[model samples]
Target: MNRKDQSLAALVAVIWGFNFVVIDWGMGDVPPLLFLAARFLAVIVPAVFLLDPPPVPWRTVAAVGVFMSLGQFGFLYVAMDAGMPPGLAGLVLQAQVGLTILLATVVLRERPTGPQMVGVALGAAGLVVVGFGRGGHVPLIALVLCLMGALMWAIGNVISRASGATGGLALTVWSALVVPIPLILLSMILDGPGALADGVAAFGWKAAVSTLYTAGLASLVGYGIFNGLLSRNTSASVVPWIMLVPPVAIGSAWLLLNEVPSTGELVGGAILVFGVLVASRTNRIRREPARQAANSVGEPNLSDPTPCTPDLPLPGTPAQPAPAVP
Candidate 1:
């Protein structure tokens, strides 16, 4: 990768990693759902006009927005507020990697490689280990909520891939817009206007800064840089670097929130990382043959080709304009 790309990636990793701590702080003041709504509101107000419309069909965009923005964030915030540690939240979210791979096999009908299958198993085992390690101490409802949140995130990932705009910032921004209204409505339904008013009244500069960091820096700049990387490198090559997030998140939580993982938690995290590495490496192997074929034909693609339109033929596969998303 070029130095510029590397720098941008590093910046994104830092922003995303730091987001855990910010969420922890922000949740102290605002209701989780309201906090999430406020976050998207911040993003939509300034950047929505600048972003182009989503490339996929409106239905696909809306579906993806629901999974990615509302479902994922809403559940995650509630889980954290329920006493899941910030650093642990980061680790748990990594489960989305495994879930996404599984969903791709199911929804996209892509076959999983051996390593990926093993990786998924290993990740499951790791979660089991973490669950048992916590014994009866951890809240079952909280754990279930976190896992559900991760599943929603995985669904969102597949939707992004389906939309044929997997690596685009415009899609991310558009999804942000698609999510905020529903999120606000949901917050009102669940928390009521009085909860919203109380939360807003409690909102201080720190909370505002936290929301800005989440919306502007983490959502916008972080995803922008991430999509930029995907547009430049293979997912396998770029994704391994994401492994860095858990540790960064853990360290940040340790320093800022004094939230330290137990030995069992650490072991669980290591296993999770190992599982993700295996899955990602396996997926990379699966995509390489297609990439090489594309490159040989002078239609080189930096990322994995979309699988939804197999008949249309990918750039390197043969001369065929890939069908527009239906």
Candidate 2:
């Protein structure tokens, strides 16, 4: 990756890292489900009307929306509300990378490479450490919910891969259309209509600002730049930058939320990050030919239509795993 694209990746990481604190602040008076609905509302609205839909089938779009948007955030927001700290939330949610690899192995019959296997094992160990360390600081139910969110994120990745949808912005906007109604309906059932109304009435400047950051900067601009880089470079080159997100998240949480991790959580998080680095690492041989060819021709090889799908985060910036989400 060039310096410019590297900077863009770093920017996305910063925006997404701080996003947890923003969400926590934003959800102050608002219920999690209602807040999530509002966040997606910001994502869809007039923007969808202006942008063209992604070329994927409607069913694929709906599937992405269900797992990526609704399922991920529904579980995530509730987990955070149940007292999972924002910084830890960012780190723990990265388990989606391992989950994605495991799922692909089973559902898609994609065997894990040696490095991927090691990465998965290390990541699982880290999660176990984090889980044991939680004790009373974070609820077990909240931890479980976060893991469920990560699993949902992994499912969305498979859907995206199966659909072969590379249209990032279009996919994000159109798929988001499937989110709000279901989330609102669920909020009505679970949180009660009274809570929904109260949340709307209590939607203050803090919440509005948070929504704008998540929907505008983190989701739209972050993913936009990320996908653009993926289009220009190899996935191997682009993916490693994502490893920066958790550190940024941890730092931002420390600065803003004053939340400190336990020694066990810290050790677990480090191990998990290392595992992800190992897992996502790819041999350069396959991409070398394309790169060399592009360099020789002084142009990009557009013939290979590899989708620029990095599962970071979309609208709500729910802690996406690897390849893509938000």
Candidate 3:
């Protein structure tokens, strides 16, 4: 990535990092699923009217929504609501890089390079360390939920990669169409009508601002700039930049929310993120030949497709994960 693109990627990391705090702040008294439903509903409007869904089947879009938007954020919001600190949440979610790769190996039949395998192993070890240490700081259930959220995000990543949809706002907004209704209905069941009513009544400026950031700035603007970068660069260059997000999230949370990570978490997160950074280094021998072959025939470089999703572009981004939800 060039300096300008580097700046933009860093900006995305900052936006997404602080987003965990924003999401937590906004859900003050609201149920997690309801808050999530509102955010996704906000994500799709006006923009959805402005463009058509990505040129993919409705089922494909729907599946992406279920896993990416609904499942990922569903578990994420609930986990945060359950007591997962924003900084740790960001760090733990980096597990998506390894999850996406393993999933792709099984589902997409995409073989990972040796470095990627080593990186995934290291990431798994880091998760184990975090798991053993999390009981003191974060709720055990919350940690598990957050990991589930990462797993869902990875599945969505694989689905999008398989579809080969050039990601953009259309895909984000359209796939998001499947998010709100399910969440809202589930929120009703879980939170109850009285609590739901109270949540709606409590919706205020803080929640609105958070929603705007998550839906508008983080989801739309962040994903758009990220897609533009991926279009211009390889996943090897782009995914590593996103690895900075955990530190940004941790720093922002410490400064803003007074949420400090434990020593164990810090060490484990460092290991996990380092593994992801290492994994981001691509196998040029495998990719360059394919890219050259495609270019020689006037074909698009299939190795790097602009993944259009609110949470992830891990198709090739996996093959290390980047561009997933905040």
Best by TM-score: 3
Every model's TM-score: 0.75, 0.74, 0.76
Cα error, candidate 3, residue 119 (Å):
3.8
Cα misplacement distance, residue 54 of candidate 2 (Å): 0.9
Over the full model, what C-alpha lDDT does candidate 3 score relative to the true structure?
Answer: 0.74
The TM-score of candidate 1 is: 0.75
lDDT of 2 by residue, 242-263 (tens): 5556666766776787767678
Order the numbered candidates by lDDT, best leading: 3, 2, 1
Query: For each candidate, C-alpha RMSD in Å?
Result: 7.5, 11.5, 10.5
**Candidate 1, superposed: residue stretches over 4 Å from native:** 1-14, 117-136, 225-244, 271-326
Question: Which lDDT tens digits does candidate 1 get at residues 1-326?
Answer: 45566566556767777898998887676778888888989877767787777567878767767887788888888889888777767767767766776676566544566776776677667765654554445477777888888899778766666555544677667777677777778778988999988988988888898999999888888766665565445343344445446666876887887766667767765786686566555334344345446545544355867534233555778665433321
Write model 3 residue lDDT over 1-326, tens digit each, in one string.
55687789778878888888889888899889999988988898889999866877899889878997899899999999999988778878767766766676566455667676666677667756654554557788998999999899778767766666665567778888888888988988988989889999989999999999899988787766665564455333444455556767776877888866677757766876776556655542133344344435533456868754334445667523222211
* Best-to-worst ranking by TM-score: 3, 1, 2
Per-candidate Cα lDDT values, in order, are 0.69, 0.72, 0.74
In model 1, residue pairs whose N, Cα or C atoms come closer than 3 Å (at least 3 residues apart or on different chains), thus clashing, are 294-316
RMSD of 2: 11.5
Show model 2 residue runs off by greater than 4 Å: 1-13, 124-135, 222-244, 262-273, 283-326
In model 2, the Cα lDDT at residue 282 comes to 48
- The TM-score that candidate 3 achieves is 0.76
